[model samples]
Structure formats: structure tokens, C-alpha cells
Target chain A: MNPIRWLVGRFPTLALARRNLSRATLRSALAVTAVVIGVVAIGAIGMGGEAFKQDQLEAYEGFGGTATVEPASYIEEGNLTNTELSDGDVDRIRQAAGSATVLSVHEPTDALVQTQSGTLLFRAQINGLANPGEFYETRNGTIPDNWRQTVVIGSRIADQNDLEPGDRLRVNVSDEFDRNFEIAAVLRPQGFSAPLGADRTVFVPTSQFESGGYEQVIVRVDTRTGSIDGASQAIEQEFNAREQVVRVEQVQEQREQFTEFFSTVNQFLIGVGAISLLVAAVTIANTMLMSAIERESEIGVLRAYGYPKRAVVSLLVAESTILGVVGAVVGAPIAVGIGMAVNQLLLGDPLAFTAVGIQYVGLGVAFGVVTALVAGLYPAWKAANKRPVEALD
Target chain B: MAPAPGDDGVTADVTGGTVPTDEIIRGTDVVKEYETGGQTVRALKGVDFGIAPADFVAVVGPSGSGKSTLLNLLGLLDVATSGDVRLRGEDVSTFTDREQTRKRKETIGFVFQSFYLIPTLTALENVEMPRMLDRTPTQTRERATQLLERVGLGDRLDHYPDELSGGQKQRVAIARSLINDPDILLADEPTGNLDRDTGDRILELFDELRTDENVAVVTVTHDDYVAEAADRVVTLIDGRVRETEDRRANFEEGPDT
Candidate 1:
């Protein structure tokens, strides 16, 4: 039917629905509140999950899958102890991980260093790197090509010690191997770069720790040419064939695991929310049945006036639908409020309002209205089937 | 005026009495039974009755005389146990529930003792309800307005039923009964709640409807005033027609008419 005709035909039905809802004020309001609670539970939980996923994706945006290869020593979880890597292993990884950049990371945790004049330098922690420029950009002077006795200090460490390039510092590498080194290049500030102290670290050539071996080999895969998975697999197989115990940490795989875990948690929360909506459906059905019973005489009068059974049933359904719609209208905004609260308190940033939330609101409304329609079916049928003569009496 | 031909070879005067050709309703041996508590109770027992267009009939009897049952059967609100009910020569007994509802909408209107006006609706809305159900043409509102005016409720168009007096509420109901221009008007104790003066005024309106609108009005009432004013009175007893008196004969040439 055309729009005008449809409106004309449904006008009376809507008017009657409004009147019926208004006439039984308390019952209708309570029914609306039940629906509101159901929609709120569903919409808020869904939106909260969406917002959290957005936040996590933003935090992990730029860090791509750079594989890290470390020795499989007996180290406990959450413990960052240094393990040995060989120069041979680094050379083999560069050849196996085709077109991938290989850098060796050295770690001698919390070694105290002092000035060349023997004046004590407070809080000077040192680390050694063979090619410090590859790991971090230089803030001032360039790295010396010879660099037989030079060191690079992190930006934070440079700012702390008033140290500059060409300055002399001494590190107690071992009890007898204590040596004085020149600061080669003061590097840029790097926070949590190598999963340990990168900011307060110093860089030295591989010659200084030739007998100590390497701690870990960092493999940078050019994702444009070869996949991270392929590079990681090649490196792992090379070590396995050499019978060298090692563990490869692929960033892409780790990220996927975290995403899967969050999705499962979200699904479980939404399932729990659905239970409240089920209870809401039962409440609407009971309320509609009672309303039908209370209006028997009015229905009889309508029948006697020659209203068809279909019309009677339609009128009752319309009333329940109106209740459902009103409840959804009231619940959606409140759910958004709760979602914002959850984001602020837990995720530390509220989700910026987006069209995505509207889809969730629409889903909530559809759920509420369908519940009401299904629940109201039996009562509407009963009202239609009542005998006019007996109902009038 | 000459007499119109009747099926029994008798004749009916057309000028001031029954018009034989305008037989609007006929019930042939209509029986109504009710099953209450596993026992059958007969409400109507093989009653043969008929009414003509523009006829004023009052069904009168004692408390359990089944007056309401007869009215319900005639209004097409309930089906007879076993018999034929013809409306304008069409057999209504075999009509489906939907067909019955359509037939009632097109031919019958009802007024009850309680007025039965929807409480939420205004006087105008209550009057327009039946026509709206039938999806009558756009002239429905105009006709309902004229009807309310004719029933002396012109100024009370927007008043809800709860705001109206018993007499006014019944007047609104009377206006509602005429909205669809049905041939038959069935009123069951329409003035049962009104005072004597108000009841008389309502009867006067019915009298006017009989002559002005040419409707077949069948009212089930116990009021003697209604019986005295009716063109004919059908007295029922024990679910049967005990007596039928034509009061018109007593005032066949009365000046007040």
C-alpha cells in the first residue's frame, strides 16, 4: 500500500494502543522498564567490547612482527635473564632469513661504570652493542669507524651524566678485563627497546665481548618482500638443524593470540547479557496476557461493532509493540552511558562516539521488539477467539 | 392506501402499518441452547418471528424470559441452535463468522442498557467507530456528526463517556447505532439506567427514528412505557412467544401520532 493509505489504516490501531497503555499506567510502565533493563544489558556489553578492541588495536598499531631469536636456556617465565648467542648463529640467521636484517643484542645487566679520572659516577648503568647505530639513532656525533675502545650512551643517560661524544668512561667488564672506553655516539632515548634496560645502556664493539658470546639475535623481516612467518620458520629450522636450542618470538603470532583471547571473553559476556533479555520476554508476555484478560468487555464491544478478529489481534499486538519501542528508546542512551563508564575506568580512554555504536543500538531494539511480538502472540489470539456474547455478559 | 400482498394470502396496510414487501428480518423456529455446568438449558424454543422495515417492536417479559437471548440472536451476535435467520430474504444461518460480522455491519446496529460506549473515546469517535470498521466512504464523519445532532448530542461531540450523564451516554449510543444507516436497530434495555423522564425522552428519539430513518427497531425492554409506545409488543415466556399485541390498533387514528 502507499504511505498515506497505510498511515490512515494504522492510525486507529495506534491511537487505541496509546490509550490502552495510558489507561493502565503502572502496568505499562513496569513492562517498559523490564524491556529497558534487557536492552541496556545487551547494548552496553556489546559496545564495551567494541571500544576495548579499538583501544588495543590503537596501542599496537606500528609495532610489526619483528622476530626475536634467543637461546632456550632454563629461564622461568617473566624472568629476563641473559642467555648466550654465537657469532656463527648470527651469520647463519642472516643467510637463512633471506633479505632480513640481523643484529646482535648484548646484555650485561646492571654493570656500574665510572669516569676516566677515577671520579665516581653515580647511577651509571652500562650495556654493550656491536653496531649501536643500527639499534638506535645517534643524537650528536657520528659512530667512529675504528671504535676499538668507544661506547655509546643512551639519551637519558647522556642527559643524566653530562657526558658527550669523545668523553672517556671506564667499565668493569670483568675483574681483570676492566677497560676505559671513549663515548662513541650518544644515542636517542629508547624506552623498553630490548625488553630490558635500553635507556641507561652503553654500546661497545663485539671485540670487547668476543669470548662472552652474544645474548640474543634480533631478526627484522621486510614484510613487503617476505612474510614474517616464513622468515621465522627459516631461522627456527636453521637452529634446529644445527642442534642449537633456541626460541623464536614472532610478534604477529603473539598479537593473534591476544586478539583471540579478547574475542572469547567478549562472547561470554554477551551471552550472560542475553539471559536478562530472556527474563524480559517472559515479563512482557505475562503483562500482555493480563491486559487482554482485563479488557474482555471492551473487546466484546469492539466485536459487536463488527471489528474482525484480525483487527482485534492487531490492536493488542500494536500495544505491546509500542511498549517495546518505548523501552528501547529509553534504554539505548543509558547503555551508552554505562559503556562510556566502563571504557573510562578500565580502558583509560572513552571511545569516541562513532556510527558503530548505532548498529549495536539497532540490534538491541530489534531484540526487544521481536521478543514482545513473540510473547504477545498467544494472548492476542485468545482475545480474538473470545465469544462476543459471553464476553459482553 | 391499498394492502400489500403477504405470503399467507393475508394483507398488510402500507400507509400507517406494516409494509409486507419490506420484510427486513425473519426468524423461523430459532432455538438457542446453553451448556452450563454439564447441563443443557434452553433459552429460545422454536420461535418464529419477523419484522418489517420502519417497524417498532418491543420484546417484553419477566426476568428469565430469554428476552436478551432473542435480541442477541436477532442482532447476529450469536448463532441459533437450529433454525434459519434471514435478513432481507438472504439466509444468515449458513453464513460464516466473518460473513456474519459483515452482514451485521451492513444491516444491524445495537444499543445496550449500559450504553457500551468505549470509555476512552469521545462522543464523535464512538459514533464513527462502526463506519470506520466497515471502511465506509469519507462521508462517514459528516454522517456521524448529523446523527449525533439528531440525537440531541450536537454540543457534546468531544465529551468522553465518563463525562456524560446516563441519559447523555445513551443518546450517544443511539447516535452510534445510526452511523452505518443499518436497516435494523437492536436495543437491549437501552434506558434501563435512566430516570423516568430521561427514559421517556430516549423513547421519543426511538419513535422519531422509526418514522424518520425508516429503521426496523427491535428493543427488549421491561418498561411499560416502551411497550405502550411500540407499534407491536412480542411477550415471551418460557423461551416461547406467549403473546403478541399490536398496540397500533388501539390508536389506529389517534391524533397524537
Candidate 2:
């Protein structure tokens, strides 16, 4: 068949798709716009969930390979054993593991650092002080083991006391003991990394930590598989067999809580996204139905020309699918931008690049297409089945 | 013109002698009934008919005479209760509406008193509709334009149906009917809505279509003058034939028979 002739034979019926939409252009545009809105909502929510998952992974990366070993004391004084892991212990783990970087840590007992501004307590929360080889996370000043009368402050502590390095500090070790001390290393903000070691901490020497001394070691293990786990398990076994008052735990419950909270938020966002899509679908259906009613006679002419009912059905479907695809294509990039903007305002960070994969975008396009078809089906069927005699009369 | 005493003049023994027995349309023992509001009313009673291919005939009757019921049956628009209707030799009683419509498109064309030209279409498009329905676009378009040219609406082809006068609309209608080159033209009072001059022109057009194409033409008219224009006239009253007359029904059988 001469395709143009066949198309012309269809007359206004062929033209009906465009004219049908044009007649109620506002309604049709609104319908497609609804699909766009739905796509944006769904894409943002889906992308946000994936971002949260990444943040959880970043939290794990901050730990590197350190095993925070706990002391063997509890319940009574609400304090675990600070059975200081001496320099020998650090050397032994380094020698035994060979593939690990080990650092021993301790927290001082009673001490108050009084400056020219005011007095702030340098109360160490046990096994948190380092002996000045260089802590991976010092907010300001290094902990000095060479000069025993010096200490380092954490980011939280520095921010809290409005203090900086090169400051003179008065340290009263207890009510009975006092000395003048210098400020050592100040630590940077470690974000969620400090849930393992110390988020709000001050570091001092092993000599300064008199009674309940250091028991833990932060082992930065360069492991591929379960080497951190293996190392921690090995240390626990060694202590258990030797009747030592110490054990190692692979602390991660805090990270798990963070993940669970984010996942719940993600599920809630998805629910809202789905509801928006459903509303968009209804708008599409309504648009098509109105168009069908407008072009009744045009469809009648096609029927009279022996164009067959299915062709009329196909024509309507094709037009709707085009509408859907156009809306989705246009909506996607706009939605991504808006998603980023929303993240910046609500999540308090200019959002990082989150790729809504091509497949996800393709699925969004497919969703738009399917929603349109679903919207167009009944209208197309009614158009196809209309009696030519009735329409002509 | 009076027959000898007791010689009824209608349906004289000429049926076996002069009239050809082979007919293009035959309706036998036909009865059509319609039920309305719990009442069964018979529209036709055991009707019988035969039409020849060359005849230009008009079936004339007053209102409520079952003339329409018989015409509908003959046109294959309605079904008979318990009878056979043959169109061009096949039993049309078994045909579905779609098949009947197809047969009508190929074999029969209709003209209505109301001049039912689709108001939205131009004269050219209206003329083209049936052909578009029946044939390829090239053929249908060529035939439609040719028919319009034939009917003298060649200049006004692009004018909408509403733009045409009654006579011009009828001319376009006539062109449309012949688009598929149908074998029979069924006109129900083709000139009923026109004035004398326009009606005469329409009748003249019908005569041209019939005489030139050799198409069998059946028209239904109430005008005695219109009846006289046909080659033969069949009068109906109370759902029964009252008179069957040729234009020269007064003549006796000559040697030409």
C-alpha cells in the first residue's frame, strides 16, 4: 500500500491524535506533567536510599583496621579494666600480625586543664590517650610522651573550650596532685569514625594514666578478607588462654543502628513516591478519555474507510506512548537537579553525585509508557467499537 | 385506454408472454413484524415481488401502506420473518448485516429524500466516500472526481454539503451512489424536497444515470407526475399492489413482443 494514501484515507482520524490532544492541550499537558512529577519523586527517593547505604559504607571505612579491645571489668564501678597494653603489647601484635599497624592507647585519671580563659576538665574516658608516636586523628596538638606533663585535646573538646594549640594548661591530676602542662595535639573532626575510639576525647601519656590504665589497642590492619576479624579473634583467644583480664570486640552496633534508621526513612520516602505515581496515572487516564470523546466523528470516518478497529486502537496507543516518553525524557534531568537541591537543603550538604543508573531511568521511561497505555486502553477500545452508523447519523 | 369489460388490464396474461421471467430481485412469501410495547404488529404480509435489471420503476403508495416495509426488505435493510429474498440470484436471507452491507456496496446504491450528505464533508469528499470505502485510493479518487465532473458539480467540488443547494446536493448524492459502479440505484423520493425546476433537473439526472449506465433504478414517489416519468410504475395500497403500468400500458401486444 502507498502508506501516505492509506494515511490520507484515514482522514481526520489520523489527524485526531494530534488534534485530539491539541483541543484539550492543557489537560493533556497536565497529565504528562503529572507523570514527570511522579518520576522525579521516585528517582529522588530511590537515589537517596542508595546514598544512605554509601554513607554507612563510609562509616565502616573510617575504622580502617583498628580493633578497640575492652578491659575485663564492668557492672560494679561501671568501668571496664584499663589493664594498660604496654609498649611490649603493641610490639608483640606488630610482630605477631606483621600485616598490621598497631597503636596502644590509654586515658588519664583525674585531671583538669585550667587555662587563662577558664578551667576545663581533661577527663580521659579510659584507653583513649596515646603516647605521641602520632595519632591518626588529632584535632590540635600532639600527645607528648617525651615530655610527660603535656596533653592533646579532641575536636569536640577544643570546640567546647574554645581552645587552640600553643596554650599553657594547668593540670591538677587529682585534688592532691597538680602540675603545669602544655597543650599537645588537637584532633580533627572524625564524623562517625569516633563511635569506635573517642568522639570527645583528650590524650595523655602512659605515666600520666596511673591506676586504671590502658587495656586497648587500635590495630590498623591492612586486610582483604576477615583479617581485622581474625586479628581480634586471635587476641581474644590469646588473652583467654593466658587468663588475661582483657578481650577484643569488633564494635559495629552503632553503625548498624545508623543503617536501620536510614533504611526506614528510605521506605517511607518510597511509599510517598508510589502514591504520587498513582495520582499521575489517574491524570493520564482522564486526559485520554476526554480526547476520545472529542474525536468521535473522526474515528467514525476511519471505521467507514475500512481502516479496521484495531488500527484505531493502535493509533491512540501510539499517541499516548509518545506523550509518556516525551514527558519522561524531559522530566528525568529536571528531577535529578531538584533531587540534588532537595538533598542540599534537607540533608545539610550540597549533595554528592548520585547516579540514577541508565537502567533506572529506562525503567522510569517504561513506567511512564505503561502508565499511558493503561490510561489509553479503555478510551481506545471505546473509539474502536463505536458504530459508524451511529456516529454518521 | 379502457380495457374491454371484465378485462382488469393489470397483470393480464402478458406475464408469461411479454415480461421476462428471469428477475434480478425476488422477494417470496415475505412477512415482517415489529413488536412495540408488548404488541406484535405485522408490517408486511406474505409479500412477493420481482424486478428486472433494465426496468426504471417506481413503487408508489400513500402513508402507512407497508410500502416502506417492502422497500426495506427489498434493499436487504430488514429481514423477513419466514421467507426468501434473493438479490441478483443469491439468497440474501442468510447474509449477515456486514455481508449485506458489502453486497449493497458492490451491487446496490441508495439515494434518500433527505439528501443525507455528511455535513462535514465537501462535495468532492462526499462523492469520494463510498469509493474510498470500496477501492484503492487512486481508483476511488479518480472515480469520485470523474463522477463529480459527470454530474456537473465539477466546479463546486470543494464546497461543503451545507454550501450546496438542494439540487446540487442531490447531484453530489447521485455521484456518490455510482462511485462503486453499483448495478442498481435505489432512490426513495429523490426529488421530494426540491422545487419544481430543481426536482425536474434531479429527475433528468436520474434518467441520465439509468439510461447511460444501464443501471436498474427503483424510486419511490408520491407524485403522479413523478410516477409518469418512470419506464414503469407499480402502485401500492394497503400493502398490496393496486396497479402495474408501463409508460405505454395502453398499447395492445404488438408483433415486437
Candidate 3:
């Protein structure tokens, strides 16, 4: 027979299962709670992981593009060094990464800034960029077109010194370079990323620090041409071929590392959740077995009424399935809510509902149902095998 | 089982005239035994009986006299240890378990002492269960409704078993039993839990069903009123039939005896 017709024939068993579950409200509720807890664990962890990954990827994207290339000696061990790269090196990187944009950065040095009164103020990193517009924008005035004695400070430095665009401050830029520079603009806040301290750094024209040379070059891989990893590899080879030591930090690779880390953590949490569901399965099995035993006479009556053994088994399975389905129905949304709550707490935003998160919810529901069905098999079989006369007794 | 003395041997005239007089159910030398702990106890030993269409027979016996065992075997709810139990002249022993279940569904009905109504379903749902296995919804519902009306429970169709009295629940069960219009109705101590008035009403209903529905009614009862109301009475003592009396003949001979 066709599947629809077969299922229609089993409607009575389904109805009977639902009715029996309703009859024992507390036991059914407990079984459903087990499924709820399991689904919640799976869904929250899955969705929360997605929100975290998206947050991290977006933060990395703040640096612009998929990968960044810098001289290998720019950082020594765990500290920034006074290493430099020529403009020719940046040009070669752009050539090797065909159709890519390479923005050159000069020395990133820390200097003590003094207010107009010469009162000692905060010491912050100073950055000189050939193309500063690629990384940041002004909150007030625009960056200076000329490369003389003007510096654009980040919001943190401006707020710390009560300085804004047009304000003048004397910087202790080494003994020979100490001078008063006009603040051309105050930059908008940028969250954490590469280059160590970009957010708090002051930006000056790259020409002002030509003697200092370029320390790093941010690579914007042309995804329209090919894979970012391939472009990064080619760029790194070009530098190595020139006998130049360089480090190519692919943002995509870092995002992948974040994804891999989240997946491992998610898997561990889902495993714990699965264990709870397993316990629930045992609970459901015990409940179904007891129900079958308690309803022995009722089963005998059904058997005497000419219901087949298969029908009896179907009835028991239907009971467990209903428990699972109902629990999932109640649990899925709560899991999403929990994910949102965690996202809001950790990332300052609600959970971003990703396609993968939806699939996890579906998996959770399927897991709950399969757990109950598998757990109920032995009990259903036992019930189906009982003799009518023996059951009636 | 002294050769079931009869002139026809195959047919019996029980109901007025419309019923076919052919024997619909027959059991020859039926024996049933059970192994309890380490000992075997025989529940039925060499019992012989036959029922025809529209026949109302009451099997009256003491507890442990195998009245229920005999009913179970005849209704195809249990297998006999030895001898043959036949439905429409075909031995049930030869049929597979599934076939026997099909036979039970198609040809036999049962009324249990406890009503056996699924408490979760309404009276109508309980009644409609028998035909719901294979019949269309409209046909099953109509038949169930008519049966409930016949049992004087048409208005109680939506009520659950817990909402009904014992007699009302039993009436629903009786309606459920007839949903498929079976040829034989096996009732085991059907009125065992009812009051005298309720029991009398149920017995009268059974009597009316015998003539009107033309179904053979076999009731295992301890109530003397049921035995008196039946057309035939078979008494059993210690797993053996002691007497089979034609109650109709005894009634016609007048109450003097």
C-alpha cells in the first residue's frame, strides 16, 4: 500500500497514543522536559557559536579585506620593532597579488604628547600612512591634503587630551623630530584588530616619515580574480624570492581558526546535551514500559477486538514520538532566545540567525524524536508480543 | 459431552424463523491446559458444544469451572490445547494467528465483564473502533451511531466512560461489539458487576439482540436470571459439561417443574 493510506490506517493507534499520554499528564510532561533540555542545549550552543563567529569576522573585516602583508621584522618575539620596508617592496606585493591594493604604512612609534601648557599627557602610538583613508575616517574635520606638520589623532587620544580638529600639541617624536603639530582631524573609534594599536594611534602623512620607511602593507586581495589564500601565497613567495622576510596574515585564515575553535567547543557542548537526551530516552523507555504494563487489560481488549501486533507496537511508538515532537516544538524557540541572550551579553548584539543555526534546531528536533523512537523499541516489542489471555489475566 | 443428543446434528431452530438454521460455531472435544508454577492445570477437558445463528446460550458454572476458558477458545481469543474449534465449519486450529485475528475481527464480537472501554475515547469513538480498522469513516460512524441508538445510548455518544454509569458503559461496549455485525457474540460475565435491575435490563437487551440482529449470543454468567432468560443453558462442573438443557423446551412445558 501507499504510504499515505498506510498511515491513515494507523490513525487509531496515533489517537490512542495521544489519549494515553494525556491520561498521564505528569509522566508525559517529564518526558517532554527531557527533550526540551536536550534541544535547548544543542540550539543555544549552535546559534551562539554562529553569532560569535560572525562578530569576530566582522571585527577582523574592520581592518579591510581578507589578508594583510607586513615585513617579517616588524614584530620581534611579542613586541613591535623599528623595522622598515621600501616602497618598492609594497609595489612588488601589489604586483604579485595581481589586481590587489597594497596600502603602505610607515613607522608605528610611541611618543609622549604635551598639551599647549606643556603639561605631560598620554603617550600613544603614532602611525604614518600613505593612504590613511583606506583604514579610518574623521569624526569631525577631514585629513590634511598636504604632508607637513599635521596629525590626525584617534577618538581615544583626542578624548583623553580634550583635543579636536585644529588643536595643536607638542609631540616628543624622538629628540630630532620633537615639534608642535596641528591636529587635522579626530578619527572615529575602531575596535580591536591587527598592527597592535591602530585604534589609539595618531595618523600623519606617509611623506612626513619617508626616512622611517614603510613598516607594513595591508593587502586587499582581489577575490574576483581568485582565492585569497592563493593570492596570499603568491605574494609571500614573491617576497621570499626577493630574499625579503615578510609575514602574510590572511584574515580569512584567522576567521577559519575562529570557526574551527567554535566548532570544537560547540561539538563538546552538543555532546553533553546529547547525554541529557540519552538519559531522557531511558526515562521515556521506562515510562512507556510501565504504561504498557499498566494497560495490559486494555491491550488485551484491543487484541480481542482484532488489532494486530503491529498496531500495538505502532501505538507505543506514537506515544514516544508525540512526547519528542511536543518537546521540540516548545524547546526550539527557547534555545534561540538563549542564544540571543548570550550574544547580547558577549557581543553587544542579539544572535545573528544563521542558516547553520536553523539546521542545528532541525537536528535537535530530529535527535529528540530518534532518541525516543529508539528507546521505545524494546518496550513496544514487548507489548506487541504479549498474549491476549495472559495480558487480560 | 454425551454425544450432544440431537436429531438434525447440523442445524438448530432457535430464533423465530428468519435466521438460517445452520450451525455457525462448533467445538468438538475442546481441551485447554495451563502450566502454573511447576504443575499443569486443565481448564477445559473434552467439552463439546455447537451454536447456531440467533441462538442465545448461557454457560452457567461456578468459579474455576472453565466457563471463561471455553468462551475464549470459542471466540478465537485463545488457542485450545487439543480438539478442534471451528467457525462456519472451518477448523480454527488450521488457520494462522493472523488469520484467526482476521476471523475474530470479521465474525466474532466480545463483551468483557469490565466493559473494556478505552477511557480516553468517547462512547462513540469506542463503539466505532471495531469497523475503523478497514471500513470508511462515514460507514463506520453511521454503524456505530445506529448501534449506540439501539443500545439506548445515542445521546451519551460524546460522553467518556468515566462520565457514564457502569450500565451505560456496558451498553457502549455492547454497541462496540456489534459495530462489525459479527455472527457470534461472546460475553464473559457481562453483567457480573451490575445491579440486579441493570443486569436484567442487559439480559433483556441481549434477548432482543438475538431475535433482531440474528447473531448467536454466548454468555458465561453466574446469574440465574440470565440462564432462565436464555433459550439454552449449559452447566459445567470441574472443566466438564454436566448438563445441556433446552430452556425453551423447559419453559414451554410450563413452570410446574
Best by TM-score: 1
Q: Go through the candidates in order and give each one's DockQ.
A: 0.29, 0.10, 0.34
True contacts kept of 2: 0.06
Q: Model 3 misses residue A216 by how many Å?
A: 9.2
The alpha-carbon deviation from the true structure for residue A108 of candidate 2, after best TM-score superposition, in angstroms, is: 18
Interface RMSD of every candidate?
Answer: 2.6, 5.7, 2.9
Q: How many backbone clashes does candidate 1 have?
A: 0
How big is the positional error of residue A184 in model 1, measured in Å on the Cα after superposition?
24
Candidate 1 reaches a DockQ of 0.29
lDDT of 1 by residue, B1-257 (tens): 11212223213422334434567766666788999999999888777667776677788989787888988888889988877677877888788889888888878888977877887788988898776644543567789889889888899999999999988998999889888788889998877878999888887787677667777778998888887777778888878777668443211111211
Give TM-scores of chain A for all candidates. 0.61, 0.62, 0.62
Model 1 Cα lDDT, one tens digit per residue, A82-107: 46777787888889889887877766
Q: Flag regions of model 1 displaced more than 4 Å.
A: A1-10, A68-227, A241-249, A340-357, B1-21, B133-138, B247-257
Sort by TM-score, best first: 1, 3, 2
lDDT for B165 in candidate 1 is: 90
Indicate the residue-level lDDT of A382 in model 1.
95
CA displacement after TM-score superposition, residue B101 of candidate 1 (Å): 1.1
